[model samples]
Target: MADRVGEQLGNYRLVRLLGQGGFAEVYLGEHIYLGTAAAIKVLYAKLASDDFEHFRKEARTIARLVHPHIVRVLDYGIEGTTPFLVVDYAPNGTLRTRHPKGVPVPLPTVVSYVTQIAEALQYAHDQKVIHRDVKPENVLFGRRNEVLLSDFGIALVAMTSNYRSTQGMQDMAGTIAYMAPEQIQAQAETASDQYSLAVVTYELLSGARPFQGAFTEVAVKHTLVPPPSLREKLPMISADVEAVEMKALAKDPKQRFVDVQTFAAALEEASRNASSRTTFLGDIPVSQEQGASFSPETIVLSQQEAQEVSPTALFTTPDVAQQPSTDELLADKPATAAMITPAFEQKEAVEAVEAVNTPVLKEKETTALTSQPPHKGISRRAVLVGLAGAAIVGVVGGGIALLTHPLGSQTAIQPGNVPPGTNGGTLYTFRGHSGWVWSVGWSPNGARIASGSGDATAQVWDATSGGHLIVYSGHSDSVYGVAWSPDRKRVASGGFDKTVQIWDATFGDHYYTYHGHSGWVWAVAWSPGGKHVASAGQDTTVQVWDSANGRHANTYRGHSGFVHAVAWSPDGKRIASASSDGTVQVWDAVTGVRLYTYEPYFTDIWSVAWSPDGKRIASASDDKTVQVWDALDGSHLYIYTGHTDFVYAVAWSPDGKYIASAGDDKTVQVWSAIDGTLVYTYRGHTAGVRSVGWAPDGKRITSGSWDETVQVWKME
Candidate 1:
């Protein structure tokens, strides 16, 4: 089809051509009256004069599937024997736009996207509709960032078999990279879509398609060879996850999961069971530590062998007449009208006035198909919550289930008894890290946050906008701890690299490296005066050093095992360290003298926090409790038994009225500082909560998690 810009068909005027594919020419279109924009997919196939009604009839069946995820077929018709389908315009482009080819998406995000796509496919299957082309290019995004599955127009031909050749239904109809074995044989069914989705999942996780090479090689591999293990690409991925992927990628359609929904749910269950610390993906699922690449566009094959076919091979054959040489304006009457209404349509009257609401589609062309992941149905809650204790049942029908699934009924927190006045929910998420975000600290001004991740990088980013400011990648291994200076100008981060690094918060310039720890450095804290930094490590020591120079001031070897955390008292006169020695040791800051040790319980302590008033101390312990005690006498006060697993992080509110604790249960709970009763329990992270900090304004909090995200939420 030639460039059809300036052509008017029904209510739409083709504005600019967006992309040219082997199947259709997609143009950015504007409605004449409503002024709404759409992607006008003008397909170039010579529909015989008598076959026009059959084309319209098959198109109507596809249009009837009105779903949030499925791209809407706003209207379709033939203009002088040319078939064109109008659909919703996705301004944000596709998933390929956000995360390009071979890019590593976070595991949590991958599961969520696949879940949304599965829901859409399940719904379409109910309508007996099978999308022949489920590749990335056909997945689009709406203006609201909703996943809109496109190109069901291909399904029209696949189901009705009108546009196929004399070889019968053996004509290849989809992108070769994601085609299932059955699809290669022209036997595409609903189960075949599930297989293709598994290929997509495999690509998303391992950053490469299961079968790669030329079309012929890939087609043969898809038929005979088994997919490479995802574990080979990402060793950190759990065996259960790899097994689920393999089951879905089975060469035989009958060996695969019953549907797309079951495969997605099984993947989710496997991901949760894997260690959040590993799945947080600091070690991305890439075969190599390099950038991304693209995929093949379209491939057509005969029943026996592969062959090149033009976009109009099915229509331009001898049975059909060639289209007119020059383009022609649409007829006054539409080829389809009142009789071809949508099946489950809900007209968005407000959405019709979006001519100026979105940026015009950029005039760009690509040979490869784009990608779009479905976004609705899978929310932050759904990502974190799955109340299946023993197993996650994918379906009551024939589906797969995991015996020891990570998704299960979580413990509920009782009503909090703390001071009331904070609005609490997730406000923003820091998603730059590829693996687990182990530590996070709010800047003194509450405007930014510093995070350390398993990606061996410490980053500074805006707390509200989630914008990156700086990424300090000097660490040689996973960065386990990070803290901002009191002035908010510098940061200190220590990790498995066994050294404490000081750097400029604004530009990520390295200032000093304290090479005093023999083992992994797990925690770092700045003094109230900002002159000294205290670093705790697996070497069983708390080393206080000069922040400006790589000079150590004191080494407090006060524990029998590794020191997990360190905190400076508000007065800066004392340092408190929590250790695997099963104690919270409070000692003098200047001298390596231990003042007192709080060991009321025989469990290891992971985190220690000083009260804002410097009158008390709190410690998170491995016994699933947060212990609060007197800073002066080390007398036990009250214990919070809220978490169902080991408590990892603890922080006091700026006002000293409330305390927050994060635990392996994947929750950040706020409680009364006076009596240790629950105030609020935040269940937004999909993995274990590793670190917690309060904003200087006292209205918000930031928590790092094994889910590889730093979530900032408002509490007032």
Candidate 2:
């Protein structure tokens, strides 16, 4: 294999053999003048087709995709009788390395890897590209734990192929360890890829293939035997997680995950019970790569890369040469930390020791360590050279660290700019709000939405197929909060007139009213379990109410000022509220006991909400900032300072990817809660936006403003 490579084939020259698999051999190659390294896979000579049809088939399948997870095909054509493919060569190697010594990985690690690969499969399956060979070796890792699915040489395109099946008819194609049972019998569907994924996950978690023995035995076992229960092998595994694994590993493809997306989501839900010990690995590194060729037809740099590349005389036009050639941009990737050592040699150690003895402080600390002061001990020139070399290494190493780094960058939004089309005029303004629309909420089914206005009316509308639903009339003064119950069977509305009203979710018929507050009612929330409800108001109190009966079970008061917002924790065990006195308070809803208060200087609090999982609370304030706090201890997590005016309302995305805030600046901003990175700003309202709410499906956001118009934004 090594001898055959490095030989010229077609218009390309293979540099060296990288790796050889069952059906093809990967070679490191460089496009003549592009100065970049690329991996080309040549089908084994005996297996190569006499005609070039398979190469075209694989290229066509790859050409239809532009996903971050799927490996990119730079170019493809026949080289003699051998069908070859050129794909991205991930520096970190395969998913197989994730289990060296054949040890089963940690459950969390297994979950993370499987989730990513499943997402890749889901993407390919959506494009009607069946990998046909889903195995550990095909999933490659890039600079930041980034996952790239490769080896599309045998990908089955759903194009005019008569071999494609609507129903199962057994077929054998993938590696036995990760192959679906149906595939062993030559019956495959998009579901076969999902089954193979489940087997990969099983290997990751248990460190052994489900059917392990001779190849023939494993093949037979897959057709007739059930996998040993994961819980039996790993007693520490949760029953929920084990059950999910069993479902994914079902012998019949139909019994397995319906698709990769469904499988990934199920894994997420099953693993939701994890605690602090569970390690969180975010997005695997994903990047767009071009072949060694630098021509326009072959390369496309991402937006960030476009900004970083500067011009040179050799490459005249910026639009043409601004992007670095593939090798230059990717050459910075470094080895994993697990593979590096910490100690330094004596000569290098001496230099660092000498630099510390200098003036001790430089205007720039980072750049100061590279030289010795006039008074320093030891050989001055030697010390300077060593430290300079060390500094160079440090800077280069840092860049590499960033390359393979797996954490996804958060969306960054400019302060007050409207998100694209949301800029100039109101898309559609509802005119019924006689007074300020204090809060707005979309129905669970998304067919309708309800708004609480100062006119003491809870107005409902058909979100789509636009029309008015009903005007729920009961409160006397300003209605403060309106929410659609989880089941969408009921709607809860609170008002300044000291009343909490329940209405029929669809018909808007007034059901029952509970009288509780002494002053203005500020907010109302239904518990996640849907059995009970909680209300907070100007009475400086929080009340727990019975949804079944129009009765207040408990009233808890602790805020020195009016309680503006109330939200039930995901577990239904606690409640969080923001008060006018610049403090966010957490309470035990059952015991009516205050848990903690998040006090940050002299900023008055405006609104507060718990994340879907209840791990954190996002509080908007008069301080012109939104502060994320730990729900348990009230410790500050992140302070979002993009709002130019007082922040009036804040809400968490259902998926928790972002936190949306509305403020007196007449702008609404969506921010990544994990890192306080702003995604987009919505600025069409002519007056202060009083409230913001995420739609149930999380595809859109609704904002109620003093401008008297309810604006709905589409989150892209």
Candidate 3:
């Protein structure tokens, strides 16, 4: 315990003293022969003589737990009755050092660190080992900032010895502020670790502990008083997330989650359910070219501003200075030309038309259209001619319609009135589904549309004609997701039935059914090579399987919440999954090793779509926005906020120019993928739009709605 720097403890050359705790002193050490660094914890000589056997037993137990998130123990022995343990050296530092008191850690960082701690604790719990002391000080970070739960199982050993030595007085093993009520009462259980973790989570998020006072007072409050609401300190903290923290701090262990993993999953789910507000972080550079940047501003439109047809309206035609020529009107169709001649023959109608042809259509035309003289005798032909001229003038000059149309009137095309090839209107509405249409996907060739419905069936139809082709109907519950293979020959559908069914896309014949998930199957994706299908669900796992025979190939179990959506990288090397756990994880498809995770400080991510080139990812979430981020490094590229409600689905255009999103806002918004500019808003759906997808050619987008219809519209 003397100055051990420049000295050797057994074979480890002690470099410098790291820190000292009550029972042990930690030092940075290096292996003499291997030249590898380690953290050496040396027991106090007096205490080691009395509790050497107990410390060795606990250290051996902790060393047996081999997990990525848990600190690995290397060597442990006694050097002349002075016990010492060697552990993996975390170069970055402990969580307490990185995020000190009164420092507000970013929400994403808090969630990520907490999740790693929870996973490590859960693994230890499964091995019948309790951490007994869970605090930020015991959580270390490695060179890559990877979280490592340290000093596992040692706290119980120290506290037990202290209790006996002090004759049942006060035990001072764990940090007072983070000790659970049960721990203070000397009856700590697995739930005690969960409670302590919650305290650390609260401190990280709000920059203050839930209860702060004298050591005795803090212990009393943990046993009796309820923690203060997190919102009082951090108003932006979502109510749901705060609730999770409070639940974990419950005095009665029975009221809390049954396991540490469950508690962590609840916190993750609460983060997604929390209301999110994002600020514009100025323009972000995407490409390497200088000045090639896209503004990350969230374009939030007021109710009135959103409803108004401004100059930047995505779907509205630009105002024209000249009227449509007679030849231009007649060139499209001969039948419309014949009707135009009769519609303009009457002199009164001709005069009315001439009035509309002026520089601007006068407000008097609106008054004339709404109020006709009751005594004036008018032929039906003249009335028809006047109406036709008004319609033609409205189409020819956009200003004429805005000026003449009544306020709050339905000027936009109605559902059934959608015209073919219309620039910004619904092209087709497939309406045979008996229940809510929850998801939709376009065929790889863009020739067919497959829709999953709450009626427990998936319907295939002609993409252009809206003709129902075939129905795949074996699921006993709602179908939530559907996908088409790259070759366009097979389709995969997942549902509340907890199964993923693969079928022949051409004939609707069942091919194979995957039955591994233990919860509702919420999403399915086909690999680029069309050989594998990935499905994820409420089971908190992503299952990759061979599409032909439904043989399970791999299972990715990183997410702690329901996995809502999954997508394969364009090259088929990686898979991306969005979860209710507020994370988007990308993993190696073949190895099943997680590659990267994107935590965007939002709650439940409902859908994730990889960009066409596989360089970026677009995610839709309950945060009422669609976010685009770099696929490799997880850097945020753009945030599109056109949707006014929770965004449920996001689809990147095949050509990589646009991103289409549908959500509870009853609208589907298309935005430029490069600049996050709102390109168009399709608002024909009368209910929340659940799913959206782009055509293979990127010319159109299709959406399924709770209104029980699938609507396909031109993107432009």
Candidate 4:
């Protein structure tokens, strides 16, 4: 069908196309009356023509299989010749966009995906629904990076439209790479889903699918192949975990685990029982090209080949058990992926399609990132919804081309004013760190900026000139936090080393180290008067110490989980600490007594900030929002809902009128401090934005990102 950018179908108005596949197209839709957003998947007319009623019944099953981890179908209808199902909109994009193809996701993140998706699959299985297709593109991220299982029953309805009782192996349906052997033989049961999930887990852990090559070869391997050992490819994975994965990937449905949940539980147990020597994060490598995707097109076998390949021929590749040698299959490569008729054309990364111009941050000549105009072909109607970030780059087969080197002249001139729009402009990008930049801060005098990186060091650089200045390499691991002393004479940085170290601002010499927290320090902050410093992290406590000496002042033990972010009230009398316990606790700065436990959200708090006047607190959360509430009574104020993924960092603009929030969505958004209306979105970074800080002069904002760069952008 042609583009229906503004067409109304049932209760939803099709705003813009989100993603398209060989069998269906997903559109960003808005509820006509309530303005609630949804993903409207429109199946081609020809496919829908034959099974319109079956499709509706399947839609009912999908809508009622409601679980926290499963996408709920809200409505279904036939618009003219096309049939569409409106489901819960996940603005954060799909896992294929986030993990890419050739990259290994952090082990912890992959396990989380398994846990949630397993529960969803178990729930669907209990209801007698076997999701024929289970892959990264079918798994989407909800508002706060929560894994959501989508395409539930979509394959069963669409691909099986021509289902005939006589059709068995000749009429199989699914993305071939993840398809179970039973599914390839048209014997899809709950166990088939289990096998598919195991394939996904293996792919996630080892960064490559076990089966590769043409659709026919991949399908045959599902029948005969004994998957390669997961530990052999990723030694970081323990043997127990490998066993669990192998059990799930068994070629015979009965040979697999009893259920997907059991498989997930076993994997979790193995991960928890990891040996003392096991390391989850091995290299922290960047994203690379993914292998050939599973296209929905049919697999054809020649007449003689089909007759010759009976059940007996399935094991002729290697041993009766092994399909092919591991060396040949695991050779990092693109396995003739179905780029042409992809079920859904996967993007390079989940570069969120801007729902309100998920705008970019321009590099102002000398910076690491420069701002650019929005891409020409992006849907303007996409802005009708509020769950996506502005698009930085379009779909590219070669992968994202990032700009990390110096782009403009290296002359230092203090930038004055640059006109600001919904998409903020980049002023400069500071480069030098050899790893992901985790934290960034503006100096008290506004002349310099401080950045902490996974390179195991913290550096101070000129804010405008992008000139390198101070480099503090005292940390033994990745530095997660960095802060400037109020007096501008010193800096405090901390991270995997578990010690908060203070150093001279000019000479990068160590001052005194604070060992109050017995954990990796995640955040560090300096008091306004320049007398005290606050550091919090995995210890689940916020520790305060004197900047002059390493003497401890007060230790706040109010949080029940890891403390991610900490901010001092403007009056300096109170401190707010956000934690994984789903609460932001405020306490008396000196006494360490609790003032209030703000529970506006029931998820992880990634960042927190205090307004300039100290009366309100703004927190970034896994709930995909920046919530502002009363600082004293903890009364709810308002939430900024522009972001589509986990909101990582939030900062109050110096003048206090605006707030800047950044997160996994890879955009730095500036919005109203009072009502939470988005003012500008800075899509400067190519990776998740981890840290944001406003310049003392209020004309600039600095943000750190996983792309391993710190970007400074103009506020004006």
Model 2 segments more than 4 A misplaced: 1-427
Assess every candidate by TM-score.
0.46, 0.41, 0.43, 0.47
- TM-score of candidate 2 relative to the true fold: 0.41
Per-residue lDDT of model 4, residues 329-431, tens digit only = 2244343322211111112111221110111222111011001111111111121011111111111111111111111211121221222343347877876
* Candidate achieving higher lDDT, 1 or 2: 1
Task: Give each model's whole-structure lDDT.
Answer: 0.68, 0.62, 0.68, 0.68
List residue ranges in candidate 1 displaced over 4 A.
Answer: 1-424
Q: Write the per-residue lDDT of candidate 3 for residues 574-654, one digit (tens) a residue.
A: 999998668999999999999889997446788899988999999988667888999998998888877655688888888
- Candidate 4 matches the true fold with a TM-score of 0.47
Clashes of each: 16, 15, 2, 21
Per-residue lDDT for 125 in model 4?
A: 91
Q: What value does the lDDT take at residue 551 in candidate 4? A: 87
Q: How accurate is candidate 3 locally (lDDT)?
A: 0.68
> What is the overall TM-score of model 1 with all chains considered together?
0.46
Over 1-716, each residue of candidate 1 has an lDDT whose tens digit, in order, gives 47789999878999999986655678999999999998898765657777777888988988898888888888988888777888878887877676776666778878887888888999999899777567677677788887777777755733332232211111221266687655554456788788878878877777777755323334544654445556666667676676677667665565567678877887887778775647456424355332222111111122121113221122111111222111121122233222211210001110111111111112110110011111112112222222111121121001112222232232232233233333348887888886567899889988889998866799999888999999899997778899989998899999876889989989999988889987678899999999999999767789998888968898998787668899999999999998866789999999878899999766567889999999999998867789999999899999999786668899999999999999766788898999987778887776668899999989988998866778998654
